[model samples]
Target: MTALPIHPDQRTPSDTSVPVSESFVSIQGEGKLTGVPSWFLRLAGCNLRCRWCDTPYASWEPESVSRPVDELCEEMRATGLRHAVLTGGEPMIFPQLLPLTERLHRMGVHITIETAGTVTRPGVRCHLMSLSPKLANSTPVGDPRDPSGKWAERHEHRRLNFASLNELIAGSPDRQIKFVVTGPDDLPEIESVLARVDGWKPDDIILMPEGVTVPDPDEVAWVVEACRTRGWRYGDRLHIRLFGDTKGT
Candidate 1:
């Protein structure tokens, strides 16, 4: 990660590389800077496979084709929005995202990233980072070629990235930690993970209820109280509330 100095006059490069699914301008629907107008750069790839993921369209499937970094920056510029959010199945899956983020920052756009926190890239000064680590309950799609024991071993290796990422975020001031809480069945595991990440503070950690398909008030209440009792924050599923699991909003 080169520490490229951000300058307003930096020219958009002519090189056409990297893939982008779509870029749109919309108010951030979740996390610390909620309701803020932000140009969303939805990159198209992910390493972790969460069972309750809503963006399966952007996960493994080939969506709309790739566009160069400069062209994507141009689309964000056209939005006339000063803030941008780079989100995806996992934005950090691509290192090119760091350069793109640097270019956007040079253009004077405040950048935020909503990621699964299983991957990290250098040189991106995220104004805010929302990191959600995948838990054991969310298993990757199993391949028959690999035995169950082998699958478990591989899964542990992949999921360890989340812990490394969480460690990095512990000292980052602009970063927030979030976990998708499903049920009481998941609470003990969530607590264990939280205990492992010593950097996570109660105020900086949030619990977001899973299953946006239907609003689960019971789960929501449980999360709210757990946050309250534990001195953590409770994050609302704003997009679900706004559009009810609709895509491309």
Candidate 2:
């Protein structure tokens, strides 16, 4: 039930230019479109810092080259792939995505935006809105990599945006909400989120195990059983299972 801070300047025209972390063709790892061949465009920058986040390079110490919409479209065209995934850091934070998704649509690519559902941009086009709302388990803490602990408070403050989650679900033709579960203890928080989102069905919910290269077998089994009991779907990190945590799949 956390509310996002008001930032009127959050959606400005300058956001049309994005910091490109990395782009590559890979198999869809999680959610409904698992196993689908997709061209991934990983953008930099995010509002929340999940403690179990797999891609720290894109969040904690983000480094990337700024690329224009047209340039990114051309890169996807070169891949000759039909499916395109706009992932992050947090893709919705950038307003440039409106143009990026529009251009990709014209190229006849099916777009899937992988997001934490903390921000919403109505103008952006998306085929599948893959919403992975952060649970309490994602609360950040001090680490050697980030000694200041600045991200801890910031992450807790912005992790959940019920308004954005509803808007994204209402607008998209298809949507899948995934939750990275640390253990059985996270179930109540997931239920609370589900209770807030009207019209969410069991089929629309997916549970994934937390980990980078490989999900712990015990955790996966526990989640699988939980999914069975709740009638929700279990999602596997296919890319990780196949290629470990290697970059670019």
Index of the highest-lDDT prediction: 2
| Candidate 1 residue lDDT tens string, 1-249 | 224344432334546456666777767777778788888878777776555567876764637567888888888888888888888878877767756877787798887788877665644556677788777766655634334545445555676564567644742447787877777677788787777776666787887777766466764787778888989888876666777877665
Candidates' TM-scores? 0.84, 0.91
lDDT of each: 0.70, 0.84
Q: For every candidate structure, what is the RMSD over all alpha carbons to the true structure, in angstroms?
A: 4.0, 4.7
Best by TM-score: 2
Pairs clashing within candidate 2 = 16-96
Model 2 stretches astray by more than 4 angstroms: 1-16
Residue-level lDDT tens digits of model 2 in 16-48: 568999999989988888898999999988888
